[model samples]
Target: MRVTRLLPAAAAVLALAGCGAGGGTKAVPPTATGSLESLAAEVKCRPNMQTDADELRQAICANSDGKFILATFATDRGQREWINDAKDYGGYYLVGRKWVAVGDDGVVKALRGTLGGDVEVGTNHSSHSMHGGSAHSG
Candidate 1:
């Protein structure tokens, strides 16, 4: 019957529409990657060199958003270690593959628009004396 056929066609159309609405429009991740200067430029910041070494490059940068510390590591291990130690101070970090932007939450979130990184929040410890307690992992 015409009614039976229309019902199945309508159901098929709805199913296809649901697929597109749910997962077909996944946002593409930001792929911008580069050195301290290039990344800073993308975010419209003038970097003031802080540390220049074989293992890492760091700079202090400021823009209309705010000031932030931008650092790039020579290796993934180096970057992770630096983040682990720095997390004790409690701050917001916009992290990429080999680089990280440390700043207040607002500034860090603003940086993510241009830098395309994950926002990580550091744990703030009032007392540094954890003694032998288990370390917190993100």
Candidate 2:
């Protein structure tokens, strides 16, 4: 019958949806990657203020002057795409192989003395490219 045929298709759809599904999204702290300690120790950030899901492993940091977010990516290419895409935003960015520091002028300038990477001051934050995936084999 029609009901029986639809049941299998509905079950298939549910199975697909279950892939990569989590119970719920969880927030990631600045220290999640253990890199937050290093940055805070070096820059004297207060080691507080975190937000959102762990999609980017993001954390907000503060010092005497201001605050910024340190976002960690799963790979170097992930970091690079974000930085490159952010050129359109024009705000300040301190990028490493796996992390990026995003903030206004004061916060970025505060850490500039010790950190190294491409930087710019602007007003917008463009979205990073995550769909351009590549495949490999070993």
Candidate 3:
């Protein structure tokens, strides 16, 4: 009797889980969406504008935690390409919607508390052989 009642509930749970199995369904939360200055404020830092252009906006920021670079991109593809290229040099990156923060692991981790994002580690080229393509310049 109890088993019969629980079967329908279990089936409904499974159906809901299958709905999200298509992948790429992860949504960037509102907390993760902001410009360089806005994001810096969340982490308690004033961004010293470095490169301000149509494609990218980068700034250096420092608070009680430490100093780091904060950048926001105009497009998603551009951001991904930049990250892929920069990885060759080896660094710590905090990735969010159209924005990325580069700093030491401790600094980046502290920033993550206020500005929710994923921490991506760059490849240390020194350990492996260098490929044909060069690192992204400016």
Candidate 4:
């Protein structure tokens, strides 16, 4: 029993030691839901954002190719509606907590992979776009 315990303890120590200076993979950044700054960091742009009284927030991240909006809904119903009634001129997404991100195919895919979330491609309305939604231009 003592030997078994020591083996487990030793394994833990080795694991900790491996992480000290020579970890295999770099750590993932701590992601923030409903945070424009955090989203901006991942997307390589300062986010232009909007928020409702309900704290429903949207952050627009763009590039030369296209743009997308990352949103946070005030209520689950609102989230459900946005998702179910979504138009796919760009990417459709629901992320952590009350967050959503929208953009075109490539942009959305890249963000989702990096930030983590649910995403879909295509758009229903031409007017519904991530373009120029930000407070500033890239």
Candidate 5:
């Protein structure tokens, strides 16, 4: 008789489990365009880098119109590190409702001006075998 009573309670628990009572889904934001002209206007000048100069220039110029849509930004150190590593030295800025990549070569990249995304600002500190120690992503 006791076994039968416990069975019903166990079944109830299992049913509730499927309803996602513990960890619910996160809501995705609606797609919307944000003005980047203000941001572009803020970008006074571009940095000089022989390696990825062209790519960086194009990205800066693209945002010059000051029209980009917001998406997601890095929230934690690990995420920021991953982004910085992926871009080699510089960091990435998500713009135009899409995740776009940008490179900053030491000189000022103007974070407050041209970036249009969630904006998770942080630092990345890691030691590479070949590169030794370097400070990246701010």
Candidate 6:
């Protein structure tokens, strides 16, 4: 009967829809390649500040050699202005310089303008390439 044929088609469509919904989505695992020394250096060199650079540097160095989690970058005017006014405090990396964000396990979760624009993560790895995006083989 036509009902039998239509039932199979309907079931197939539902199954296909379920599969499609589940597919095409991936998780971005945390990275573990960050250094506190680099972070400190960035804080020390941050522009537009009225704090005791040397003291701040020493304090940051004291806290160096540890792991951190969750980091973000800013490519907007507001964020840049905030960094300038805040003297680069807190636990965020300074962009426009080579900086990286690490996870609790010390992996590089995300990278910012350190590599320059026009590049994304998981790309190739060549010295000539920006953002560490270069072709590789194993």
Q: Which candidate tops TM-score?
A: 1
- Model 2, 47-107: lDDT tens digits are 5534333334555665654556666666676556555655444556666556667665545
Task: Give the total clashing residue pairs for model 1.
Answer: 0
CA error at residue 37 for candidate 2, angstroms: 2.3
- Best lDDT goes to which candidate? 1
> For model 1, how does the per-residue alpha-carbon lDDT over 22-125 read when each residue is reduced to its tens digit?
11223436956889899999989898886777777877777877777888888898888777766756677788999988877667666776677788887766
Candidate 4 structure quality by residue, lDDT tens digits, 47-135? 66544345355555564334556566677776655655454222334355566665544554456556666554434444544665654
TM-score, per-candidate, Cα-based: 0.70, 0.51, 0.68, 0.52, 0.25, 0.19
Which ranking of candidates, highest lDDT first? 1, 3, 2, 4, 5, 6
* Candidate 3 residue-wise lDDT, 1-138, digit = tens: 111222232223223322221112234344478778788888888988866778878777777767777878899987887777665556677899899887666666677776778889976554444575555646
Q: Which stretches of model 4 miss by more than 4 angstroms? A: 1-34, 63-65, 88-91, 121-138
Per-residue lDDT for 52 in model 3?
78
RMSD of 4: 20.4
Looking at model 1, residue 101 earns an lDDT score of 83
Candidate-wise lDDT, in order: 0.68, 0.50, 0.67, 0.48, 0.30, 0.27
Candidate 3 positional error at 106, Å = 0.6
Q: Between candidates 3 and 4, which one is better according to lDDT?
A: 3
Question: In terms of TM-score, how similar is model 2 to the real structure?
Answer: 0.51
lDDT, candidate 4, at 69: 60
**Any idea what lDDT model 6 has?**
0.27
